[model samples]
Target: EHKRTNMNEAIVEKLHGTLSILRRERDEVHRAKELAMERLRLAKEETERMERTLQASKQKYDALMAQSTNNSNSNSNNNCSNGSDGHGGKVNESVEIMQLKKEVERIGREAKFQHMEYVSKRDTLAKLKNHLKAEDAQRSKNIRIAQETLKKRRAKLANIQALARNHISTDGTSGGSASRGRANDNGNDSGISGGAGKGKNRTSASASAS
Candidate 1:
């Protein structure tokens, strides 16, 4: 009877261990399933988010394309209004955009070239103007110097003329005084001769009377 009880106790312990092992395995599997479900849910949410983003990107692209088409149509209409063939109906928007890009580049190049030319011309003009101004200033200085010299020469000439006039007057007076002195001397000699002649005639008359 003791052997039977021991055997029953061992059996009961073995069954309990097996049930505990099974319960642990089942709980592990359930946890694993839950983790898998969570992962799937996260993947689904990410996919939906990506899809929404893609849809939004697509919509934005469509809107931009529509706007570009409208702008291109309007530009074509404007070109046609100006009697242009709007690219001759053979060129699409992309081709026209490329052509426009090339044209813009060409225009930019031309503008740059023109700007450089203008700068060069402006510099040349500035130099010319400076040179002209310098020449003018030099001319002005020369004119002023010439005028000053002329004024000085005129003053000298005037002084010389005054001195010449004074000298001429003084010489004329001296000449006149010398001529008057000579005339006085001649008259004195004539008077003396006349007196001598009268005395001789008187002496002869006295001798005849004696």
Candidate 2:
């Protein structure tokens, strides 16, 4: 029974340790999840801003293309009327239009990339959530087992006390028996001494009479 109690206590200790580890892991997982969510939110906001920039660039590019068409027509009429060159203006307008188009494309690519990153991180967060759920389940199970073992330990404590009392009582009984045995031995020695003294006295009287 004592051995069983020791084993129970060991199991309870192990379960307690396991609970502590699980709690630490749970806390770590929660922090990781929170960090991931913060990153995702920032990424989402950035993606939206990039998309808005892309749209503005597209609108500007379209306006430049329309203006280029109008300027070309106006330059043709002015060249016919005043005999002047407008090639430099056209070249600068075309370059501006091209730059705006490129900016639009670049912004679009960046928005798409940020979106993909958000999706991947979101998936990772889901996995972490599932792992946290499993950890909670295991921790709860360990708690229940520990509680049961503690009850057994309490019962074992009572048994141990009872055993100690019985042991003390048995030792007291044995000590009393040993003391009685010693008294009997002392009584026998006294009787033997008395018989020897009487025999010595009888011999002395018989010798005196002779």
Candidate 3:
């Protein structure tokens, strides 16, 4: 009984230790999950800021394009007026218009490049968001698995405790029966010894009488 009790106590202690370790692991996983969520939030904010910047750039590009078109119309009117002045003025006007056209083309190219860059950045931000989402999902899955595992461990611990209780109870109930059986055996042995002793005395008496 003492040995069995010691064994059960050892097992319970070991299980409690394991439960503590598992709790620590669960806490760490929860912390990781919080960190991941924070990162996702920051990523979303950054993407929003980028989108706003891209929108502003697009608006600026559109305004510049409109101004360039207006400038082209104005230059055309000036050329028409200066055409009658002389070959020199016409040549100078044409050069000025060519320079203006070049400037407009350069601005258009810059706007196109800027738009492409914006698109690339947007795509990259989208991918980042997706990646963060996946990470969040994976973290959630890990937490759920951990929780399930913890539940199972608790259930196992409960079963171990129940079995231990049953074992102790059975030993307690049978203890009296075992003790009674031992006592009866001792009594039988004593009676047999006494009867043998009496038989020896009787033989001695008959021998003396003879």
TM-score of each: 0.50, 0.66, 0.43
lDDT for each residue of candidate 1 in 1-210, tens digit (9 for 90 to 100):
345445545554554555465456556655655565565555555555555555555565556557668877887788878876555443565565555556555555555555555556556555655665565566556555655655665565556666767878999999999999999999999999999999999999999999
Off by over 4 Å in 1: 1-91
lDDT for model 3 comes to 0.66
| Top TM-score prediction, candidate number | 2
Q: How many clashing pairs does model 2 include?
A: 0
lDDT of 3 by residue, 1-210 (tens): 455556656665665666566566656656765665566566556555655655565565566567656666766787798873244644665565566556556655655565565556556656765766676666667656656665666666666677878988999889988999999999999999999999999999999999
Model 2: per-residue Cα lDDT over 1-210, one tens digit each? 567657756765775676577567767867877887788788778878887888888888889999999999999999999999799999999899888888888888988888788788778878877886787777777767766766777677668767867888999999999999999999999999999999999999999999
Relative to the true structure, how large is the alpha-carbon lDDT of every model?
Answer: 0.62, 0.82, 0.66
TM-score order of candidates, best first? Answer: 2, 1, 3
Q: After TM-score superposition, what is the CA distance of residue 81 in candidate 3 from its true location, in Å?
A: 1.8
**For this target, which candidate reaches the highest lDDT against the unseen true structure?**
2
Which 10-residue span in candidate 1 carries the lowest summed lDDT? 1-10
Q: If both were scored by lDDT, which would come out higher, candidate 2 or candidate 3?
A: 2
TM-score of 1: 0.50
Which segments of candidate 3 are over 4 A away from where they belong? 84-210
Error (Å) of candidate 3 at residue 202 is 30
